[model samples]
Target: MRQDTLWVHREFRQLWAGQTVSQFGTYVGQTVLPLLAATSLGPRPSRWGS
Candidate 1:
């Protein structure tokens, strides 16, 4: 294979790895933040304007 082709492949692999990790972190944060908010804030009264 040509050197240029090899470089392209390496760059693609790096990009794929980065995107995968970023997506995983996003999913973890999405899952964790709501749980944290619920635990910390507990229930609140309705705000339907008195």
Candidate 2:
């Protein structure tokens, strides 16, 4: 019987790495975009509840 593991596959490794980078970029954008927008727009007391 021959056993094969995904860790031994080059294509799988590349795919996994690309997915990881994409996820990290998405996470960074999600976290940073809001902060960037808030900083650029400044604070308005009237919009606090709405």
Candidate 3:
């Protein structure tokens, strides 16, 4: 008897691989964008109103 599994299908494997890579890129962007924004901006003002 042949084993049945989603991994056995070529299209599912391709889709799974693509999704994995997309998710990783999303995580990396979410982490890095904020750090970049904070570093690029100037320090906070000492007082709200002078």
Candidate 4:
């Protein structure tokens, strides 16, 4: 397999920046999703003793 050396090239900075922004948005979504799931679970769903 060939490794993409785009990381060493200055021209790829825009691509990297866009990827970084997208990844950060995904990270925020993942953090909030667990809380959303907890809220939607039914009355006796205290599995972790919360």
What lDDT score belongs to each candidate, Candidate 1 first?
0.86, 0.87, 0.87, 0.79
Q: Residue by residue across 1-50, what tens digits does model 3's lDDT show?
A: 24598888889889999999999999879998888888998578868668
lDDT of 1 at 16: 86
The candidates, ranked best first by lDDT, are: 2, 3, 1, 4
Clashes of each: 0, 0, 0, 0
**Tens digits of per-residue lDDT for model 2 on 1-50?**
23477888789889999999999999889998888999999987885576
User: Please, what are the lDDT tens digits per residue for candidate 4 over residues 8-49?
Assistant: 676687888999999998987998787778788846846689
By summed lDDT, which 10 consecutive residues of candidate 3 come out lowest? 1-10
Q: Is candidate 3 or 4 superior in TM-score?
A: 3
Task: For residues 1-50, write the lDDT of model 1, one tens digit per residue.
Answer: 57666446977889889999999999879998899989999988978957
Candidate 1's TM-score reads: 0.51
TM-score: model 2 vs. ground truth: 0.61
Model 2 gets an lDDT of 0.87
**Superposing all C-alpha atoms, what RMSD in Å does each candidate have to the true structure?**
4.7, 5.1, 3.8, 8.6
List candidate 4 segments past 4 Å from native. 1-11, 33-50
